[model samples]
Target chain A: MRAGERAYQALRADIVEWRLLPGQVLGEVELSERLGISRTPVREALSRLTADGLTEPHSGRGVVVATISAEDVRSLYEFRDSLDCRAAELAARRGDPEVFRALAGELLEALEGLTSDDDPDHASYYELVQRMDAAIDEAAANPFLRQAQTGVRLHLARVRKLSKSDPRRLASAAVEHQRIAQAIADGDPALAIATTRVHLSNALQHALNTKELAPVRPAAS
Target chain B: MRAGERAYQALRADIVEWRLLPGQVLGEVELSERLGISRTPVREALSRLTADGLTEPHSGRGVVVATISAEDVRSLYEFRDSLDCRAAELAARRGDPEVFRALAGELLEALEGLTSDDDPDHASYYELVQRMDAAIDEAAANPFLRQAQTGVRLHLARVRKLSKSDPRRLASAAVEHQRIAQAIADGDPALAIATTRVHLSNALQHALNTKELAPVRPAAS
Candidate 1:
């Protein structure tokens, strides 16, 4: 891989995984030295990260990871409500039925393992949701929409860390995914849109409630 | 303005205005010389344009302007239907009533001048549409949604050149904008979404027809 791309992927993974917390300063020289690369590639990667809204310029501290407030979460889901619903509708209209059918079956199977107390199952369920998202984007066959959806999902990934421990939310989300998959498999655009709306609304509520009870940042090291 | 920003604005204007035709190779040295800037800034500008989907990397040709097919127009409108509707709905809920009321009045006045033979009026009508778009985005007040909408509008600008000569289309579009503005002014989300849907459907039809009739490119200069 190209050095810039490698740096981008590494930095992006760190940010998304919350290994690099929000508001953490990312000095280009420090990152270049730590990653064993030249400053050029690190600078390029930081520019891309800023473009992706993952980081922002600080007056004197270089770039810092962007923080997600409750308001940001609310706005993110509101935007997702439009994007996910449209994606599901388009996927139903243009997607391969067999692909969605297989996905529906997989989602159903995944739901069976999603108990309220199983942490591993919740992790796997999130993975299944990501797969479903990819399948829907593929089925939709619109590059522009996919690009927009991808941008929103990047932030959604970061926000997911704020609510990942809720088992009940995981279980309900699994059922919601099943409904969306089945609707797409059946080639029902309206049903797919409706189900997606429900899923996004439920997910937003859970994110908001979880955010209310949890601290947004880790204890200072 | 910064050199990169200058290059970006100049190149973007060329693309949107069709001076830089789709599929035309964008040689870095040539553009830098023409724009009177260094290759570094021109390169950065091209990179930004690529991110905007206005250009793409070719196998042997470096980067060339991206082409829009009939299918691309279809897909663009399908995505716009979702975006414009959501933006209008949000604007209705959150926007300033007086702003839209004034915009609606302006649209109504523009409609009066949009006769089939008056080309200048048509240009002004399109500008009004752009202002209304900006106002609605401002009212929606979500930076993420605005960003997504702005990306889509970048391509939409290129597509507009494909169908700008149709006076009847312009007149009807003016009326449609008036309705959307009025709905937002009245704080009716449902009405705003409904009018936006109508406008997008009409726009898609017009673009598809225009693509069918117009040659995708001009003969060699």
Candidate 2:
């Protein structure tokens, strides 16, 4: 991979995972020194991040990580519903039935494995979700739609890190994925869209409740 | 505006208006000389265009304008329907009704101005359409959706230039915009979405027919 692309991916991951917190200043020199790269790549990465809305140019402060508010979260989910539901519907119409059927089976197994509350299995679960997202993007076969979904998902990933994962929500989310997978496997566009809507609504409600319980900070320390 | 931004906008407009046709090579030296700018700003503009999917890198060929096939146009419309319909629905739910009502009135006036077959009033009509799009984006009030729409519209603008304008289609398109504006003014989300669907369907049909009648070619000369 190119140095600039590598820097971009690493910085994006850090931002999404909250390692690089909101409102944090992203100086090209500082980032380049820390990442062991030249300033040019760091500058390139920051420009891409700005385009992604993960960071913005600030007066007298260069570029800083973008801050999210409660209203931002609300608007984000509303936008997600529009793109994701449509993606699900398209996947149902054009996806490989066998691939989705297999995904449905794996989701069921993942749900069963989530019985132990102590072990969240979050990593594996998120991996499954990523795989499902890739499948849907491939199945939809629209580069424009795929690009839009990717842009939304970047912010969504950052927002997801804002809330602590609840075991109950995780289990329910797995079930929701299963239903979505089954609907796509069956080539039922309406059912896929409906299920996607339900999943997003539940996820949004959970995020809102969690945010109210534990307010986010800028992570200055 | 910064030199890079000025270059980016100028190049983007040229590409969208078909002055810089698909498959054309975009050498930095050539564009910089033509635009009376430095190679630095031209490079920045090229990168931005690549991000917008207007130009792509070719091995041993440098960067070239991306081509649009018939299938590409079809997929573009399909993707537009998903995002645009959702945007219209959100505009109806959250937009200023007075703004849309006034827009509906303007669209009606524009329709009247299109009576002569020879006098298409294409430029003014497109400007009005752009105004409506901006209004809907502002009314939707979702930055993520707005960003997605902006990205999609970049490509949509390029694809639009592929077809020759028809006066009859232009008149009907104005009426369709009026219906959408009226629905948004009435705060009817479902109606707005439905009207947007009809408009997209008709527009796609027209584009397809036009493409079949007159094929697009890269402006090598």
Candidate 3:
């Protein structure tokens, strides 16, 4: 991969992981030195970030990490609720049963470990989600739908990052995934969609609660 | 607004309305003269278009107006269905009842004026959708949802422009809006979402069918 591409990927990961929290200054010279790249590649990476909505362009000079408000979370769920339901519906109808079965097995294995964990943070389930996302992508049957999912998923990542660690919630979420996978395996499109919607609504409500309890973002300086 | 802004707006409108078909070359000099602007503003406008995903950068110079493919259409709808549903749900839960009632009134008025020979074509209906969207925006209390709606609506413009023109479809659509408005007005969140989903599914199916029937892009020269 090119130097610019590497910087872009690294910066994206940092943003998604909340390591570069909202409104963090992204000085080109500092980032170039940190990533061992020249200012040119860092500049290109920032441009890409601006395009992705992860960074806001400064007054013709630099960029800052984008901010997310409570309103952003609400809106993100609204998009997620609708898109996930439709994706589940299509996945149930179009996805390969064998692939779903394999995903279910993997998900079940992950859940088995998480269920025993007294405290499982977002990191524990990250890989499991990638598997689920791959399954959803394959089942969606429409490239446009997949692209839309990408945008929603980005927003969801922020929401998930702030959510409090709750074993009960993790268990319930895993169960919900199992139900959705079962519905897909059965070719029950309506059931799959409905199950997915319920799961998302509950998750969204949990996220909202987490936001309420967490310290509010200090107003932008 | 500068000349470049004017050119961008005019070109965007033309493209959205299918007045300028896909693969149209956007020559900077010609567009500059047409909009009474210098090439600098035109170039700036093109840069913005590249960011907006409405135009693609060329290998050497200039840009191509965006053209949608079957794949693009499907992906667009997947995202749109999710965003629209979320809009409907939020509109029901948080939007003012009066807003929905007013939307109902406008839709009915439009319905009353409809004539068998006066079917609303894609362009006209596209304008009409703006009114419907205004209602959704007013109802959705979140800015993120609103911004997401804008993205989905723009992409939907292409698929919508391709849908077959039938008085029946228009009348049916108006009726769907009436039901959706009623659900929102009544504070029936589930009903509002369900009705909106039905409306979108029908519209998407219609659009997909029309797109499939439309002649394939003439063999790229």
Per residue, candidate 1 scores C-alpha lDDT tens digits across B1-221 of 78988999899989887888777888888988998888878877887888888989977566898877887888888888888999999999999999999999998788777763565646677788889889999999888989888988988888876665777887888888899999999999999999999989988888887654245673242
Can you write out model 1's per-residue Cα lDDT over A1-221, one digit (the tens) per residue? 88988999999989887889877889988999999999878877887898899998887567998887888888888888888999999899989999889888988887778763455646677787788899999988888889988888888888876565766777688888899999998999999999999988998888887764235573252
| 2 or 3, greater by TM-score | 2
- Pairs of residues clashing in candidate 2: none
Order by lDDT, highest first: 2, 1, 3
Per-residue accuracy of model 2 over B1-221 as CA lDDT, tens digit each: 78999999998999888888788999988989999999877888888898889999977456898888888888889988988998999999999999999999999998888875445547777899999999999999988888888888888877777677777888899999999999999999999999999999999999888764236576574
* Model 2: residues with Cα > 4 Å off, grouped in runs: A117-121, A212-214, A219-221, B117-121, B212-221
Cα lDDT of candidate 1 equals 0.84
TM-score of 2: 0.94
Q: What is the CA-based DockQ of model 1?
A: 0.74
TM-score of chain B of 2: 0.91
CA RMSD (A), model 1: 2.8
Best by lDDT: 2
lDDT of 2 by residue, A106-160 (tens): 9999887787654554788889999999999999998888888898888888888
lDDT of 3 by residue, B1-221 (tens): 55766876777777677776667788889888877878766776776666666778777468887778766776676667667777787788988899788778877777765554454454455466677788788778666567666766766765566666777777788889888988888888899889988998887777777675245452242
